[model samples]
Target: MSSPVILEDLQEAFPGWCIWRSSAGRLWATRNGRRLSQYEIDHGLCQTIDADDVAQLAEQLREQEAAERAL
Candidate 1:
């Protein structure tokens, strides 16, 4: 199960989006009725994170999206 705090951070970082974990434990974030990011958590990797990590992920996503838009 994913941490509620992390989910909350995602919500704050991307308002009006749906953030949830699938039954298989993959984390997903969607915005404007579209999928934004999907983090696979079943790889025995990071299953949880601190607030700073959440902030970093959000920033990274923003940068990626900006770069994509620039292309």
Candidate 2:
């Protein structure tokens, strides 16, 4: 998979942004469905991903796909 797809998959695997109704009604990542503050989401996404880690994941996925294709 490509970098974008890898990122998408990672998001899907972990907690993801969703429609939330709370003090603030909007997409949120909190378990309570409360709209997460900008700081919350920013820090959360950062904790979930590192730039180097994402690049490594993308490279691994690409190599796997290439191997599959070769078969």
Candidate 3:
């Protein structure tokens, strides 16, 4: 099986959120400081929220952070 995405990489892509993987190779993500297992990320349920969207998410997050800093 292909290796799952690293937790640190996901966390970097999604700043301010906590992302990690379980021993069972499950991916988890949290935005409100609450951990939620994102099976879709592992099972390819949502492309927009999957590994391919990492760059997009990172850009969006950067924009949000910049906006927040401007306030």
| Runs with alpha carbons beyond 4 Å of true place in candidate 2 | 9-52
Off by over 4 Å in 3: 1-7, 13-15, 18-30, 33-52
lDDT of 3: 0.46
For every candidate, C-alpha RMSD to the true structure in Å? 9.9, 13.5, 10.6
Query: For model 3, how does the per-residue alpha-carbon lDDT over 1-71 read when each residue is reduced to its tens digit?
Result: 22224556656555666555456655544454433346533542222232234444455445545644554
**For model 2, where is the 10-residue window of minimal lDDT?**
43-52
Quote each prediction's TM-score: 0.42, 0.32, 0.39
For model 2, residues 1-71, the per-residue Cα lDDT tens digits are 23444445644533332212235422222232445456654543221222345445445344433543554
Candidate 1 residue lDDT tens string, 21-44: 667655655444543333332322
Against the reference, the lDDT scores of all candidates come to 0.48, 0.38, 0.46
lDDT of 3 at 34: 38
**Structure candidate 2, residue pairs in collision:** none
Q: In terms of lDDT, which candidate is stronger, 1 or 3?
A: 1
